[model samples]
Target: MDPALLKAREAFKKKAFATPVIEAKRPVTSNQESGKESNKKPRKSAPAPVAEKTFDFKKYKPSSNANFACLAKIVKYMKQRYLDGDNEPLTLEDMLDETNQLDLAPRQRQWLATEALKNNPKVDITEDGQKYFYKPTFPLKDKKSLLRLLDKYDQRGQGGIPLEDIQESLPNADRCIKALGEAIIMLTRPTDKKKILYYNDRSIQFKVDDEFQKFWRTAAVDGLDDAKIEEYLEKHGITSMKDVGGKNSTPMQKRKKPTSKKPRNFKKHNEHMGDILQDYNG
Candidate 1:
């Protein structure tokens, strides 16, 4: 034990003593954390409300009465021109001038001229340069002659009259001819055969009656056999012959016939012969 103890003491003396070690120090807060907290993005603000634009239509309202009055005046002037035998077609400028002579206001004159051109085919506008001119479409002096010519064309059922002839007849012949065409189309349609036979937008359509319908069907079927006719009649519930004709009629009378009789058998000889034989045997 002494020897082992001495060896242990020697070994303990030769061993080096260890010093306590310290870890490298670091800051408590990280740059990344600081940056995240400091540089957080702000929320976006809501958009502002936009102002709405308003439109005013009152400034553009048109007067029906004024327009009609202007049109009437224009028609009167055109009628006069037609009577004067000025067959040259009138333009929008001519109409505006006429309206001015009538003492209409600037706006009123323009409105009237526009109305006249719109309602009458005898008025037209020409873009001669930067501005447009108004004039009659025919060679006639005025509206009355225009009306007469229109009536004549309508009665005659003619359309597309020559522009030169119209101009020669009325100064505003182009418009007149167009108006006449429109009038004829409106007044003489096929539907207006009753009360008024002619209108711009109507026509006369004749109604088909039962007889006509029957005729139509018969014509359509043409050359049908008895069986085919019977099938048609049965399918259509045409029970009686009169039903096919669409009316009732008298029953057909029976034809007279010659009378005939059966011939009688006159055979009494066999019975008499049997009686004679019986008597001979007895």
Candidate 2:
């Protein structure tokens, strides 16, 4: 064999015998093991799921064939349910319980509210995101902002505010309520302890008495003016319409006017004819 061939063969044998070596890594220490575990972050235990409150259909389902007089009437009923001290949070299901459908889904309630109740002015049914709320009728268009001025124990559609308090909240609140008329009125509350101004006839005090109704009718007819309202209120002997029938008392009525007969046009017994003749001649 040639020298170059012999040299090549020797190189191939040496290259084949040569093996590559990899460096061995160091073993973890106790502290390093703890660090590893901490770094691994213990597969994050999944969060416990929250349970949703289920609606009670059998107990709370509305009347099947009942006909509400109007949307206002329906709102009135719903508001009374709240004010009656049964004041659970309202759901569209309760409002449309008139439909008699037990298996109403959330989306279905939304659709029903949008389609059936949204446009009606008699009642103020409102939706925020997916939640539905019953807003009271306000004379002003911004019901939400104006309503924020109120304090609610149960639900707040009706006004529990006093006249002076309301006046403080809104300068024209009286005029606004007057312009709104029966939409919001002064009435005894469900408790009947006080006469508070309410919006949309939401309280059980809705059953206005003869004198109470007469005052409002008279006020509306007399027109919306402080002077007229004061005079009319005074004429009715009504210091305050609040607690109108408290403790089984009759509602306030106007003070009776004194009666007296007018004098006759006939002449006096003596000298009347002669005096009249002389005066006519003069």
Candidate 3:
């Protein structure tokens, strides 16, 4: 470096840049100024947000609500069939008789019939003109439930109460029966057979299988329920729930829920790792 240039640079840096000062009329000591500042009221910070107390009012278990809606509609159709006559079920052509005003398309009718048959065994689908379903309405829902109800209200000699009265009381009768894959046997039939009548003498009954009842009773259980469910699995030749596929299914891969109060991943690291700063490239 040139001595003159270095000297000039140092001199320029050391040069004082001064401006005229205008002081306040009353000047106080550092302590007095600080004291005065301290005396002034401190600013109030924003109030902390009040957390809302959340309440869970939901009672129903998680289910396919859309499927339930469709089921309800199908149930309504079944009830209508029962009301019409406990004789021959409606034909494909006769399906839209009541709702003919809705002007349903062919595809729509097919879809509805398909859904109705899926959950309902009582619904019989056969092709005539178009592929149509025969949904016969039953007097009650599940065979066991119907049997119990009948036993409760049976008049012995007079058989059961009027069939119309039972039909009126049981709105979801046919749907329940269909869902359970059970049948209702007409205990009393007109001697004429061809003649349809809802006389007080008419009685109904169901044959609820023991195996089905046991299976249904233990349906809502984990695979770990070895006592009852294991027997069922063995009888049906089912090794795992994964083998049985349906709407309400048990997932094979069970993962633990992630929690907020833990260090994620592994915490421990290699002790002999070299200094990180030495390897810096980026």
Candidate 4:
């Protein structure tokens, strides 16, 4: 081994270079910090997503309102025909042409003439072998006959007749009603909004003031049930008088029918084949 070279390397290591010193950092100024903040802008948030609209694909049905409207037009046409002295029932095509409703779709026209007219109370539909004919529900042919019927109703003391019936029966019904202004009382029923024609008996009727009539009508306890009405009346210092005791009706007893006797069973002289053979031999 070379001892001299090893000793020389150890001596070189012992005379090594001195350690390097680190430099201190300078402090940041307020102006530099403000400048840095000003250079950087605030980030914006992303916008919310919008919902997509969907279409409704439900199947639509044919409305009865359109059918009734068409039926009304046809009825008006029928009334006009009756006025023109045509008592005969009109065919489907004839009615459509006369009412200027020929432009309606074939299916709609067919439905209007058949089902709509048949179901309507104001219309009378009749079939002639292959095709249908439509007419107003007229029990009588003329205005005179309608007046006679009304007079009959008045004589019978039957409360009143429906004006709708007369309208459906007679032509120029409005004119007839107007002509009978003083002779009849036209009333509207609250339940169904139906117009009723009451025969005004001049002998029994006396004129009442319009103001008094209005007051009476406005004082009605509308939209109240019987219990609520009673409560309201009592609250307003008005109470209905209690009913007095009356004799109660006795319930009738059901009568029983007498029992029928059953028929007696008689013995047969020759019930078996051997007995029948002996009888034959005798």
Candidate 5:
């Protein structure tokens, strides 16, 4: 044995005698040791309240169909006449004649007139003794401008001739100098209420109210005739006359038949058909 080997054996034997250590687990606590718990289960949240909606029954109700059939017929006739290039405004008499021909009742006729007039502002009613007449308020070409003028006048609240006011209201005095002068003359002179005066700008204002009546009376005294009225309207470039039923012609003429031909062509057609049938048979 060597001295180094003896020392190594002694060191191995001493290191083989090392000890092992273990730690103990702690005890669990009961409910009494911890805070007390409630027996009741937590309440579930209530569902959010739903909002109630409101509805209006009136909004769903059907509207009245008053005068619908008559209105339709009038509209159809007017449209046909319009498309045929008849630019003349339909008179009340013309409309009444058409209604009567269609066998519409008096009430229905009135309703039709109201409806037509509502659609066409150019249609107006005038009185001649016990009779009523319808005349065109605007020309076919100037309908839009005429409507605009009607709206403008209605908005301005100036129904009567506002000659001085209109002249003063003009934007350009230099450009409208001649028109202003003419308006002054018209204001001073008498003219029919049915006669309209159109400005260069296409705005229309009628001669109305007591002042206009006074003017007409004075013109009548001065022997003013239809030709003079026409000349005045021409000077102002007025394209249409409204409420001219009794004013346009004499009472007798207004009462006279609008058409010279017989009522429709019923007899002529029957005769023509008879001749054709005879020829065919022969």
Candidate 6:
């Protein structure tokens, strides 16, 4: 072999024997570990799903023989079971079987479970980490009982019962409230804006002149506080129950006697001054 060929072969051998530049492989980690490694932030667990307060009935078509009013039948069955002291959570299959709805088609069954039964106002559904189950919303079955509850709350002077509570108790709460007409006063709470239902006593509901109502509504008391309003009313020969009871005096706070704090003996200089100077010098 030529000298040049020999030198080339030696160079090739040297190159082949040289240390291989292998890229360092990062150790594999789990999804949770990888998330922490990448962002240096602990992964936030998903928020638990909140239950819906209301269901839109318009989204579903009217119940017919097709679905066999599966939801209504189930509600009735559950309520009966509840009254009989059997308040155990019933499965969809169990509800369907009980309500003679096992013969429903797959799509219809799915609809009944996901939409109909779950959205029924009379049904109280819950999931126990394993499977979803159903129960009755409340023990009271009729609008009369709901009205009685409202009357009881009103009589007790506990402000007004929550509309959500009424809805949860009564199956046809909207219809019942509508049928009640002016017999119920529905007011929206200022804080959360949730509707509150107050029972109206027709015996005490005296008719007021339209002009007086207009005057009352047009009167702007927006900037006036209760005290200012009361003062103004008193000046005009109008006295409120609050004024008749007399004003309450503010309780005076007792002044604490000067605590004899031992006069912080003023040292002419800091005790550690020499030590501090020595440390700085060193």
Best by lDDT: 6
On residues 1-282, what C-alpha lDDT tens digit does candidate 6 reach at each position?
A: 699999999999999889587799897669868777888766799999998878555465545776756666777777656555466787888777887878766677677767776666666666552224434344456667767877887889877888876665566678878987887899999999999988887787688999999999998899998888888887888865464656689999999988787767765777668666655464
lDDT of 2 by residue, 1-282 (tens): 699999999999888789666899998899999888888855788989999989764455333333223344456565454333343344565655743454554544444466545655433443453323434343323334445444241254553666544543343455556665565547666664565765443555556589987887774554565556656777889767544434555879999886987786986666657656544464
Per-prediction TM-score: 0.25, 0.21, 0.23, 0.40, 0.20, 0.38
Candidate 5 worst ten-residue window by lDDT? 129-138
Model 6, position 214, has a per-residue lDDT of 100
TM-score of 6: 0.38
Task: In angstroms, give how far residue 109 of model 3 lies from its true place.
Answer: 2.7
**Model 3 per-residue lDDT tens digits across residues 225-280:** 54576577778987686445445557699888876778669766664565543644
* Per-model CA lDDT versus the true structure: 0.57, 0.54, 0.54, 0.71, 0.49, 0.73
Query: Best-fitting candidate, measured by TM-score?
Result: 4
For residue 222, model 6's alpha carbon misses the true position, in angstroms, by 2.0
Off by over 4 Å in 1: 1-63, 76-85, 89-101, 112-122, 129-190, 194-282
- Estimate the overall C-alpha local distance difference test score of candidate 2: 0.54
Candidate 2 residue spans exceeding 4 A from truth: 1-73, 85-89, 98-111, 122-129, 138-282
Clashes of 3: 0
Candidate 1 vs candidate 3: the TM-score winner is 1
RMSD of each: 27.6, 29.2, 38.3, 19.3, 28.1, 31.3
lDDT of 1 by residue, 169-270 (tens): 465545654655655432323463422212233244467799988887876557887668778878988767534544546899998774876588887767
Model 2 steric clash pairs: 195-242, 195-243
The 10-residue segment with the lowest total lDDT in model 2: 61-70
lDDT of 2 at 280: 47
